[model samples]
Target: MILSLLGRLGRLWIVPVALAVWELAAREARAVYFPPPSGIALHVYELWFSGPPARLFLTDDAVAHILPSLGRLLLGWSAACLLGVVAGVALGRSARLSQYLSPLIHFARSLPPPVLLPVFLVLVGVGTPLQLAGIVFGVVWPVLINSIDGARYIDRQYLDTAQVFGLSRRERLTRVILPAAAPKIFAGLRLSVALALIMMIISELLGSTEGVGYRLLIAQSQLDILTMWAATLLLGVLGILFNAAFLAVERRVLGWHRAAL
Candidate 1:
Protein backbone atom coordinates (compact mmCIF):
# COMPACT_ATOMS: atom_id res chain seq x y z
CA MET A 1 0.00 0.00 0.00
CA ILE A 2 2.79 2.39 0.90
CA LEU A 3 4.61 1.67 -2.35
CA SER A 4 1.46 2.15 -4.37
CA LEU A 5 0.71 5.44 -2.63
CA LEU A 6 4.29 6.61 -3.13
CA GLY A 7 4.15 5.72 -6.82
CA ARG A 8 0.94 7.73 -7.22
CA LEU A 9 2.44 10.74 -5.45
CA GLY A 10 5.65 10.40 -7.42
CA ARG A 11 3.72 11.23 -10.55
CA LEU A 12 3.33 14.77 -9.12
CA TRP A 13 7.11 15.28 -8.89
CA ILE A 14 7.00 18.21 -11.30
CA VAL A 15 4.82 20.34 -9.00
CA PRO A 16 7.33 20.59 -6.15
CA VAL A 17 10.22 20.99 -8.58
CA ALA A 18 8.42 23.82 -10.31
CA LEU A 19 7.63 25.52 -7.01
CA ALA A 20 11.25 25.18 -5.93
CA VAL A 21 12.43 26.82 -9.15
CA TRP A 22 9.89 29.61 -8.69
CA GLU A 23 11.01 30.14 -5.11
CA LEU A 24 14.66 30.40 -6.13
CA ALA A 25 13.92 32.68 -9.09
CA ALA A 26 11.76 35.02 -6.98
CA ARG A 27 14.38 35.14 -4.23
CA GLU A 28 17.12 36.00 -6.73
CA ALA A 29 15.05 38.67 -8.43
CA ARG A 30 13.68 40.16 -5.16
CA ALA A 31 10.79 41.66 -7.09
CA VAL A 32 8.09 43.46 -5.11
CA TYR A 33 5.22 42.20 -7.27
CA PHE A 34 6.63 38.68 -7.39
CA PRO A 35 7.25 37.16 -3.99
CA PRO A 36 8.78 33.77 -3.25
CA PRO A 37 6.46 30.81 -2.73
CA SER A 38 7.76 30.50 0.83
CA GLY A 39 6.69 34.08 1.60
CA ILE A 40 3.32 33.53 -0.04
CA ALA A 41 2.73 30.35 1.93
CA LEU A 42 3.63 32.06 5.18
CA HIS A 43 1.40 35.02 4.40
CA VAL A 44 -1.50 32.74 3.59
CA TYR A 45 -1.02 30.90 6.87
CA GLU A 46 -1.13 34.13 8.82
CA LEU A 47 -3.92 35.67 6.78
CA TRP A 48 -6.39 32.82 6.83
CA PHE A 49 -5.13 29.60 8.43
CA SER A 50 -3.86 30.68 11.83
CA GLY A 51 -6.91 30.22 14.07
CA PRO A 52 -7.36 27.85 17.00
CA PRO A 53 -7.43 24.10 16.51
CA ALA A 54 -11.16 23.88 17.18
CA ARG A 55 -11.87 26.13 14.23
CA LEU A 56 -9.85 23.86 11.95
CA PHE A 57 -7.09 26.47 11.80
CA LEU A 58 -9.38 28.88 9.99
CA THR A 59 -8.96 32.48 11.01
CA ASP A 60 -11.56 35.23 10.87
CA ASP A 61 -10.41 36.30 7.43
CA ALA A 62 -10.64 32.74 6.23
CA VAL A 63 -14.17 32.30 7.56
CA ALA A 64 -15.27 35.62 6.13
CA HIS A 65 -13.80 35.13 2.68
CA ILE A 66 -13.66 31.38 2.07
CA LEU A 67 -17.10 30.50 3.39
CA PRO A 68 -18.99 33.03 1.28
CA SER A 69 -17.18 32.00 -1.87
CA LEU A 70 -17.87 28.34 -1.13
CA GLY A 71 -21.52 29.00 -0.36
CA ARG A 72 -22.06 31.02 -3.52
CA LEU A 73 -20.12 28.56 -5.65
CA LEU A 74 -22.12 25.59 -4.40
CA LEU A 75 -25.51 27.27 -4.62
CA GLY A 76 -24.90 28.72 -8.06
CA TRP A 77 -23.46 25.51 -9.47
CA SER A 78 -26.32 23.42 -8.12
CA ALA A 79 -28.96 25.69 -9.64
CA ALA A 80 -27.15 25.72 -12.95
CA CYS A 81 -26.94 21.92 -13.00
CA LEU A 82 -30.65 21.52 -12.27
CA LEU A 83 -31.69 24.12 -14.80
CA GLY A 84 -29.36 22.88 -17.53
CA VAL A 85 -30.38 19.23 -17.18
CA VAL A 86 -34.12 19.92 -17.17
CA ALA A 87 -34.03 22.40 -20.04
CA GLY A 88 -31.61 20.35 -22.13
CA VAL A 89 -33.53 17.11 -21.68
CA ALA A 90 -36.84 18.79 -22.43
CA LEU A 91 -35.47 20.48 -25.52
CA GLY A 92 -33.83 17.29 -26.72
CA ARG A 93 -37.09 15.36 -26.38
CA SER A 94 -39.09 17.91 -28.34
CA ALA A 95 -38.17 18.61 -31.95
CA ARG A 96 -40.66 21.46 -32.32
CA LEU A 97 -39.58 23.27 -29.15
CA SER A 98 -35.90 22.96 -30.11
CA GLN A 99 -36.55 24.30 -33.59
CA TYR A 100 -38.28 27.39 -32.21
CA LEU A 101 -35.71 28.06 -29.46
CA SER A 102 -32.48 27.06 -31.20
CA PRO A 103 -31.68 30.50 -32.55
CA LEU A 104 -32.33 32.26 -29.24
CA ILE A 105 -30.39 29.64 -27.30
CA HIS A 106 -27.39 29.98 -29.59
CA PHE A 107 -27.50 33.75 -29.45
CA ALA A 108 -27.66 33.79 -25.66
CA ARG A 109 -24.87 31.23 -25.42
CA SER A 110 -22.58 33.25 -27.65
CA LEU A 111 -22.68 36.32 -25.43
CA PRO A 112 -20.12 36.41 -22.60
CA PRO A 113 -21.48 35.98 -19.10
CA PRO A 114 -19.62 39.04 -17.85
CA VAL A 115 -21.47 41.10 -20.38
CA LEU A 116 -24.69 40.18 -18.62
CA LEU A 117 -23.38 41.27 -15.22
CA PRO A 118 -25.03 44.62 -15.59
CA VAL A 119 -28.35 42.98 -16.26
CA PHE A 120 -27.96 40.71 -13.26
CA LEU A 121 -27.12 43.66 -11.05
CA VAL A 122 -30.12 45.53 -12.33
CA LEU A 123 -32.36 42.60 -11.49
CA VAL A 124 -30.95 41.33 -8.21
CA GLY A 125 -28.78 44.20 -7.06
CA VAL A 126 -25.41 43.28 -5.50
CA GLY A 127 -24.57 40.60 -2.90
CA THR A 128 -25.31 36.85 -3.24
CA PRO A 129 -28.08 37.09 -5.80
CA LEU A 130 -25.92 38.83 -8.36
CA GLN A 131 -23.07 36.39 -7.84
CA LEU A 132 -25.33 33.37 -8.27
CA ALA A 133 -26.97 34.80 -11.36
CA GLY A 134 -23.57 35.41 -12.92
CA ILE A 135 -22.30 31.95 -12.05
CA VAL A 136 -25.42 30.10 -13.24
CA PHE A 137 -25.55 32.03 -16.51
CA GLY A 138 -21.86 31.43 -17.18
CA VAL A 139 -21.61 27.76 -16.26
CA VAL A 140 -24.94 26.41 -17.53
CA TRP A 141 -23.99 26.39 -21.23
CA PRO A 142 -21.63 23.41 -21.16
CA VAL A 143 -24.07 21.20 -19.30
CA LEU A 144 -26.96 22.44 -21.44
CA ILE A 145 -25.20 21.76 -24.73
CA ASN A 146 -23.84 18.38 -23.69
CA SER A 147 -27.11 17.20 -22.16
CA ILE A 148 -28.97 18.24 -25.32
CA ASP A 149 -26.55 16.39 -27.53
CA GLY A 150 -26.52 13.34 -25.28
CA ALA A 151 -30.30 13.10 -25.13
CA ARG A 152 -30.73 13.85 -28.81
CA TYR A 153 -28.20 11.30 -30.04
CA ILE A 154 -29.22 8.31 -27.93
CA ASP A 155 -29.11 4.97 -29.81
CA ARG A 156 -32.47 4.40 -31.52
CA GLN A 157 -32.31 0.81 -30.33
CA TYR A 158 -32.56 1.93 -26.70
CA LEU A 159 -35.60 4.10 -27.40
CA ASP A 160 -37.30 1.35 -29.36
CA THR A 161 -36.58 -1.13 -26.59
CA ALA A 162 -37.96 1.26 -23.97
CA GLN A 163 -41.11 1.75 -26.07
CA VAL A 164 -41.44 -2.01 -26.58
CA PHE A 165 -41.21 -2.43 -22.83
CA GLY A 166 -44.19 -0.05 -22.44
CA LEU A 167 -42.24 2.51 -20.48
CA SER A 168 -43.84 5.90 -19.86
CA ARG A 169 -42.23 9.10 -21.19
CA ARG A 170 -41.00 10.01 -17.71
CA GLU A 171 -39.62 6.51 -17.19
CA ARG A 172 -37.85 6.60 -20.50
CA LEU A 173 -36.25 9.92 -19.68
CA THR A 174 -35.32 8.99 -16.13
CA ARG A 175 -34.12 5.44 -16.78
CA VAL A 176 -33.08 4.83 -20.37
CA ILE A 177 -32.18 8.32 -21.58
CA LEU A 178 -30.44 9.60 -18.49
CA PRO A 179 -28.46 6.42 -17.94
CA ALA A 180 -27.28 6.28 -21.53
CA ALA A 181 -26.36 9.97 -21.48
CA ALA A 182 -24.42 9.75 -18.25
CA PRO A 183 -20.97 9.97 -19.84
CA LYS A 184 -21.61 13.14 -21.81
CA ILE A 185 -23.51 14.73 -18.95
CA PHE A 186 -20.61 14.02 -16.59
CA ALA A 187 -18.15 15.58 -19.02
CA GLY A 188 -20.21 18.78 -19.12
CA LEU A 189 -20.67 18.80 -15.33
CA ARG A 190 -16.93 18.59 -14.76
CA LEU A 191 -16.34 21.53 -17.09
CA SER A 192 -19.08 23.53 -15.35
CA VAL A 193 -17.43 23.06 -11.95
CA ALA A 194 -14.34 24.96 -13.08
CA LEU A 195 -16.40 27.61 -14.81
CA ALA A 196 -18.55 28.04 -11.69
CA LEU A 197 -15.44 28.63 -9.62
CA ILE A 198 -14.29 31.27 -12.07
CA MET A 199 -17.65 33.02 -12.24
CA MET A 200 -17.89 33.02 -8.45
CA ILE A 201 -14.61 34.87 -8.25
CA ILE A 202 -15.53 37.31 -10.99
CA SER A 203 -18.88 38.12 -9.43
CA GLU A 204 -17.33 38.60 -6.01
CA LEU A 205 -14.58 40.78 -7.45
CA LEU A 206 -17.13 43.02 -9.06
CA GLY A 207 -19.45 43.06 -6.03
CA SER A 208 -19.49 41.62 -2.51
CA THR A 209 -18.24 42.65 0.92
CA GLU A 210 -16.25 39.45 1.42
CA GLY A 211 -15.08 36.41 -0.58
CA VAL A 212 -11.87 34.77 -1.82
CA GLY A 213 -11.98 37.07 -4.82
CA TYR A 214 -12.50 40.08 -2.58
CA ARG A 215 -9.35 39.17 -0.67
CA LEU A 216 -7.38 38.97 -3.89
CA LEU A 217 -8.73 42.29 -5.14
CA ILE A 218 -8.00 44.03 -1.85
CA ALA A 219 -4.52 42.57 -1.68
CA GLN A 220 -3.80 43.70 -5.21
CA SER A 221 -5.08 47.21 -4.63
CA GLN A 222 -3.19 47.54 -1.37
CA LEU A 223 -0.05 46.28 -3.08
CA ASP A 224 0.25 43.52 -0.51
CA ILE A 225 2.31 41.36 -2.84
CA LEU A 226 2.59 38.29 -0.65
CA THR A 227 -1.13 38.19 0.19
CA MET A 228 -2.01 38.58 -3.49
CA TRP A 229 0.23 35.68 -4.40
CA ALA A 230 -1.17 33.70 -1.51
CA ALA A 231 -4.75 34.29 -2.66
CA THR A 232 -3.82 33.16 -6.15
CA LEU A 233 -2.13 30.05 -4.74
CA LEU A 234 -5.23 29.35 -2.68
CA LEU A 235 -7.38 29.53 -5.80
CA GLY A 236 -5.12 27.04 -7.59
CA VAL A 237 -5.31 24.66 -4.64
CA LEU A 238 -9.12 24.97 -4.52
CA GLY A 239 -9.37 24.19 -8.24
CA ILE A 240 -7.29 21.04 -7.88
CA LEU A 241 -9.23 19.91 -4.83
CA PHE A 242 -12.61 20.53 -6.50
CA ASN A 243 -11.60 18.70 -9.68
CA ALA A 244 -10.18 15.73 -7.77
CA ALA A 245 -13.28 15.38 -5.60
CA PHE A 246 -15.58 15.64 -8.62
CA LEU A 247 -13.53 13.10 -10.56
CA ALA A 248 -13.84 10.60 -7.71
CA VAL A 249 -17.62 11.00 -7.66
CA GLU A 250 -17.81 10.74 -11.45
CA ARG A 251 -15.79 7.55 -11.46
CA ARG A 252 -18.09 5.89 -8.94
CA VAL A 253 -21.28 7.03 -10.62
CA LEU A 254 -20.11 6.02 -14.09
CA GLY A 255 -18.57 2.71 -13.05
CA TRP A 256 -21.66 0.81 -14.18
CA HIS A 257 -21.68 2.57 -17.53
CA ARG A 258 -18.07 1.63 -18.03
CA ALA A 259 -18.74 -2.02 -17.14
CA ALA A 260 -21.56 -2.22 -19.66
CA LEU A 261 -19.35 -0.76 -22.36
Candidate 2:
Protein backbone atom coordinates (compact mmCIF):
# COMPACT_ATOMS: atom_id res chain seq x y z
CA MET A 1 0.00 0.00 0.00
CA ILE A 2 2.79 2.43 0.84
CA LEU A 3 4.63 1.65 -2.39
CA SER A 4 1.46 2.09 -4.45
CA LEU A 5 0.75 5.43 -2.77
CA LEU A 6 4.29 6.59 -3.36
CA GLY A 7 4.12 5.54 -6.98
CA ARG A 8 0.94 7.58 -7.50
CA LEU A 9 2.47 10.57 -5.77
CA GLY A 10 5.57 10.35 -7.94
CA ARG A 11 3.47 10.23 -11.07
CA LEU A 12 1.45 13.25 -9.98
CA TRP A 13 4.58 15.21 -9.16
CA ILE A 14 5.63 15.34 -12.82
CA VAL A 15 2.97 17.89 -13.71
CA PRO A 16 4.04 20.40 -11.02
CA VAL A 17 7.71 19.91 -11.83
CA ALA A 18 7.03 20.59 -15.50
CA LEU A 19 4.93 23.62 -14.65
CA ALA A 20 7.66 25.01 -12.40
CA VAL A 21 10.19 24.63 -15.19
CA TRP A 22 7.80 26.35 -17.59
CA GLU A 23 7.23 29.18 -15.10
CA LEU A 24 10.95 29.77 -14.67
CA ALA A 25 11.48 29.68 -18.43
CA ALA A 26 8.70 32.20 -19.05
CA ARG A 27 10.11 34.49 -16.32
CA GLU A 28 13.61 34.28 -17.77
CA ALA A 29 12.37 35.01 -21.28
CA ARG A 30 10.17 37.88 -20.00
CA ALA A 31 7.61 36.87 -22.57
CA VAL A 32 4.37 38.70 -21.95
CA TYR A 33 2.58 36.37 -24.32
CA PHE A 34 3.56 33.37 -22.21
CA PRO A 35 2.32 33.76 -18.68
CA PRO A 36 4.09 31.78 -15.96
CA PRO A 37 2.44 28.87 -14.18
CA SER A 38 1.77 30.92 -11.05
CA GLY A 39 0.11 33.67 -13.05
CA ILE A 40 -2.04 31.19 -14.95
CA ALA A 41 -2.95 29.44 -11.70
CA LEU A 42 -3.99 32.77 -10.17
CA HIS A 43 -6.19 33.44 -13.18
CA VAL A 44 -7.68 29.96 -13.00
CA TYR A 45 -8.55 30.48 -9.36
CA GLU A 46 -10.20 33.79 -10.05
CA LEU A 47 -12.24 32.39 -12.90
CA TRP A 48 -13.29 29.43 -10.84
CA PHE A 49 -14.15 31.35 -7.67
CA SER A 50 -15.00 34.87 -8.83
CA GLY A 51 -15.72 36.57 -12.10
CA PRO A 52 -17.10 39.90 -13.27
CA PRO A 53 -20.83 40.17 -14.01
CA ALA A 54 -22.21 39.22 -17.46
CA ARG A 55 -20.09 36.07 -17.62
CA LEU A 56 -21.70 32.66 -17.30
CA PHE A 57 -20.56 31.88 -13.80
CA LEU A 58 -20.78 35.07 -11.78
CA THR A 59 -19.12 33.12 -8.98
CA ASP A 60 -17.50 30.52 -11.22
CA ASP A 61 -17.81 31.73 -14.78
CA ALA A 62 -15.61 28.96 -16.08
CA VAL A 63 -18.46 26.49 -15.71
CA ALA A 64 -20.70 28.62 -17.88
CA HIS A 65 -18.23 28.73 -20.74
CA ILE A 66 -17.30 25.09 -20.31
CA LEU A 67 -20.88 23.81 -20.33
CA PRO A 68 -21.75 25.46 -23.65
CA SER A 69 -18.67 24.10 -25.33
CA LEU A 70 -19.33 20.65 -23.90
CA GLY A 71 -22.94 20.75 -25.03
CA ARG A 72 -21.98 21.61 -28.59
CA LEU A 73 -19.36 18.88 -28.58
CA LEU A 74 -21.75 16.22 -27.30
CA LEU A 75 -24.56 17.15 -29.66
CA GLY A 76 -22.38 17.11 -32.73
CA TRP A 77 -20.38 14.04 -31.69
CA SER A 78 -23.50 12.03 -30.82
CA ALA A 79 -25.02 12.73 -34.23
CA ALA A 80 -21.80 11.77 -35.97
CA CYS A 81 -21.54 8.54 -34.00
CA LEU A 82 -25.08 7.49 -34.84
CA LEU A 83 -24.90 8.27 -38.55
CA GLY A 84 -21.33 7.07 -39.02
CA VAL A 85 -21.91 3.70 -37.37
CA VAL A 86 -25.17 3.04 -39.21
CA ALA A 87 -23.80 3.97 -42.61
CA GLY A 88 -20.52 2.18 -42.04
CA VAL A 89 -22.24 -1.01 -40.92
CA ALA A 90 -24.55 -0.99 -43.93
CA LEU A 91 -21.70 -0.32 -46.32
CA GLY A 92 -19.56 -3.01 -44.74
CA ARG A 93 -22.35 -5.57 -45.05
CA SER A 94 -22.87 -4.79 -48.71
CA ALA A 95 -19.85 -4.72 -50.99
CA ARG A 96 -21.88 -3.40 -53.94
CA LEU A 97 -23.21 -0.50 -51.86
CA SER A 98 -19.71 0.22 -50.57
CA GLN A 99 -18.37 0.41 -54.10
CA TYR A 100 -21.13 2.76 -55.14
CA LEU A 101 -20.56 5.17 -52.28
CA SER A 102 -16.76 4.91 -52.04
CA PRO A 103 -15.94 7.78 -54.36
CA LEU A 104 -18.35 10.22 -52.75
CA ILE A 105 -17.27 9.27 -49.26
CA HIS A 106 -13.62 9.72 -50.17
CA PHE A 107 -14.29 13.13 -51.68
CA ALA A 108 -16.22 14.36 -48.68
CA ARG A 109 -13.68 13.07 -46.18
CA SER A 110 -10.80 14.61 -48.09
CA LEU A 111 -12.17 18.12 -47.74
CA PRO A 112 -11.18 20.08 -44.60
CA PRO A 113 -14.17 21.15 -42.54
CA PRO A 114 -12.55 24.50 -41.64
CA VAL A 115 -12.47 25.49 -45.28
CA LEU A 116 -16.20 24.75 -45.53
CA LEU A 117 -17.12 26.74 -42.43
CA PRO A 118 -17.90 29.79 -44.56
CA VAL A 119 -20.10 27.72 -46.85
CA PHE A 120 -21.90 26.25 -43.83
CA LEU A 121 -22.28 29.74 -42.37
CA VAL A 122 -23.84 30.89 -45.63
CA LEU A 123 -26.19 27.89 -45.78
CA VAL A 124 -27.13 27.51 -42.14
CA GLY A 125 -26.26 30.95 -40.71
CA VAL A 126 -24.16 31.47 -37.56
CA GLY A 127 -26.06 29.33 -35.12
CA THR A 128 -26.02 25.99 -33.33
CA PRO A 129 -26.65 24.15 -36.58
CA LEU A 130 -23.56 25.59 -38.22
CA GLN A 131 -21.41 24.76 -35.21
CA LEU A 132 -22.83 21.25 -35.06
CA ALA A 133 -22.23 20.83 -38.78
CA GLY A 134 -18.59 21.80 -38.41
CA ILE A 135 -18.07 19.40 -35.51
CA VAL A 136 -19.90 16.56 -37.24
CA PHE A 137 -18.05 17.12 -40.50
CA GLY A 138 -14.69 17.16 -38.75
CA VAL A 139 -15.34 14.00 -36.71
CA VAL A 140 -17.64 11.74 -38.75
CA TRP A 141 -15.03 10.43 -41.14
CA PRO A 142 -12.94 8.70 -38.45
CA VAL A 143 -15.96 6.89 -37.03
CA LEU A 144 -17.24 5.87 -40.46
CA ILE A 145 -13.91 4.65 -41.75
CA ASN A 146 -13.05 2.81 -38.53
CA SER A 147 -16.46 1.19 -38.33
CA ILE A 148 -16.27 0.05 -41.94
CA ASP A 149 -12.81 -1.38 -41.42
CA GLY A 150 -13.94 -3.13 -38.26
CA ALA A 151 -16.96 -4.68 -39.97
CA ARG A 152 -15.04 -5.77 -43.04
CA TYR A 153 -12.32 -7.43 -40.98
CA ILE A 154 -14.73 -9.88 -39.32
CA ASP A 155 -13.66 -13.46 -39.97
CA ARG A 156 -15.09 -15.25 -42.99
CA GLN A 157 -15.42 -18.40 -40.87
CA TYR A 158 -17.75 -16.59 -38.52
CA LEU A 159 -19.93 -15.57 -41.44
CA ASP A 160 -19.95 -19.10 -42.76
CA THR A 161 -20.96 -20.45 -39.40
CA ALA A 162 -23.78 -17.90 -39.15
CA GLN A 163 -24.92 -18.82 -42.64
CA VAL A 164 -24.92 -22.50 -41.78
CA PHE A 165 -27.11 -21.74 -38.77
CA GLY A 166 -29.60 -20.06 -41.13
CA LEU A 167 -29.47 -16.85 -39.11
CA SER A 168 -31.21 -13.87 -40.62
CA ARG A 169 -29.12 -10.87 -41.69
CA ARG A 170 -30.35 -8.74 -38.81
CA GLU A 171 -29.64 -11.47 -36.27
CA ARG A 172 -26.17 -12.05 -37.68
CA LEU A 173 -25.38 -8.37 -37.50
CA THR A 174 -26.79 -7.73 -34.04
CA ARG A 175 -25.53 -10.90 -32.37
CA VAL A 176 -22.17 -11.39 -34.06
CA ILE A 177 -20.96 -8.63 -36.30
CA LEU A 178 -21.66 -5.73 -33.94
CA PRO A 179 -20.02 -7.36 -30.96
CA ALA A 180 -16.93 -8.16 -32.98
CA ALA A 181 -16.71 -4.68 -34.42
CA ALA A 182 -17.26 -2.87 -31.12
CA PRO A 183 -13.58 -2.20 -30.41
CA LYS A 184 -13.02 -0.43 -33.68
CA ILE A 185 -16.20 1.55 -33.23
CA PHE A 186 -15.00 2.60 -29.80
CA ALA A 187 -11.66 3.68 -31.25
CA GLY A 188 -13.52 5.85 -33.75
CA LEU A 189 -15.58 7.32 -30.94
CA ARG A 190 -12.47 8.19 -28.95
CA LEU A 191 -10.91 9.89 -31.95
CA SER A 192 -14.14 11.71 -32.74
CA VAL A 193 -14.55 13.05 -29.21
CA ALA A 194 -11.25 14.93 -29.38
CA LEU A 195 -11.98 16.16 -32.87
CA ALA A 196 -15.44 17.25 -31.83
CA LEU A 197 -14.06 19.34 -28.95
CA ILE A 198 -11.55 21.03 -31.27
CA MET A 199 -14.25 21.82 -33.79
CA MET A 200 -16.51 23.16 -31.07
CA ILE A 201 -13.84 25.68 -30.05
CA ILE A 202 -13.09 26.58 -33.67
CA SER A 203 -16.75 27.20 -34.40
CA GLU A 204 -17.04 29.41 -31.34
CA LEU A 205 -13.86 31.29 -32.20
CA LEU A 206 -15.25 32.10 -35.63
CA GLY A 207 -18.45 33.69 -34.34
CA SER A 208 -19.94 32.98 -30.95
CA THR A 209 -21.62 35.19 -28.38
CA GLU A 210 -20.61 32.89 -25.53
CA GLY A 211 -18.20 30.03 -24.85
CA VAL A 212 -14.61 29.69 -23.69
CA GLY A 213 -13.26 30.54 -27.09
CA TYR A 214 -15.37 33.67 -27.26
CA ARG A 215 -14.23 34.66 -23.80
CA LEU A 216 -10.63 34.12 -24.85
CA LEU A 217 -11.17 36.37 -27.84
CA ILE A 218 -12.72 39.01 -25.61
CA ALA A 219 -9.80 38.82 -23.24
CA GLN A 220 -7.41 39.17 -26.13
CA SER A 221 -9.16 42.26 -27.41
CA GLN A 222 -9.09 43.81 -23.96
CA LEU A 223 -5.45 42.83 -23.44
CA ASP A 224 -6.42 40.89 -20.32
CA ILE A 225 -3.60 38.36 -20.16
CA LEU A 226 -4.83 36.88 -16.90
CA THR A 227 -8.31 36.27 -18.28
CA MET A 228 -6.86 34.82 -21.46
CA TRP A 229 -4.71 32.44 -19.43
CA ALA A 230 -7.75 31.54 -17.36
CA ALA A 231 -9.69 30.70 -20.49
CA THR A 232 -6.82 28.60 -21.80
CA LEU A 233 -6.52 26.75 -18.50
CA LEU A 234 -10.25 26.13 -18.58
CA LEU A 235 -9.91 24.67 -22.06
CA GLY A 236 -7.08 22.42 -20.92
CA VAL A 237 -9.13 21.22 -17.97
CA LEU A 238 -12.12 20.58 -20.21
CA GLY A 239 -10.00 18.55 -22.58
CA ILE A 240 -8.68 16.43 -19.73
CA LEU A 241 -12.18 15.93 -18.35
CA PHE A 242 -13.54 14.96 -21.73
CA ASN A 243 -10.78 12.42 -22.29
CA ALA A 244 -11.15 10.97 -18.80
CA ALA A 245 -14.91 10.57 -19.16
CA PHE A 246 -14.54 8.87 -22.53
CA LEU A 247 -11.87 6.56 -21.17
CA ALA A 248 -14.10 5.59 -18.28
CA VAL A 249 -16.98 4.85 -20.61
CA GLU A 250 -14.75 2.90 -22.94
CA ARG A 251 -13.38 0.81 -20.11
CA ARG A 252 -16.86 0.08 -18.80
CA VAL A 253 -18.18 -0.84 -22.23
CA LEU A 254 -15.13 -2.86 -23.25
CA GLY A 255 -14.24 -4.52 -19.99
CA TRP A 256 -14.08 -7.91 -21.63
CA HIS A 257 -11.43 -6.68 -24.07
CA ARG A 258 -9.10 -5.70 -21.25
CA ALA A 259 -7.88 -9.26 -20.97
CA ALA A 260 -7.12 -9.32 -24.68
CA LEU A 261 -5.20 -6.08 -24.42
Residue 117's lDDT in candidate 1:
83
Candidate 2 residue lDDT tens string, 100-206: 98899888888876887888888888767888899999999989988888888898898899999999989999978998899999999898888888888888888
* Candidate 1 lDDT tens digits, 1-261: 999999999999999999999999999999888888888889999999999899999999999999989998999999999999889888887788888988888888888888888888888888999999999999999889888878888999999999999999889988999988889889989999999988888888888788999999998899887888898999999999999999999999999988887
Per-model TM-score versus the true fold: 0.94, 0.88
How far is 237's C-alpha from truth in model 1 (Å)? 1.2
What CA RMSD would you report for each candidate? 1.6, 3.1
lDDT of 1 at 118: 85
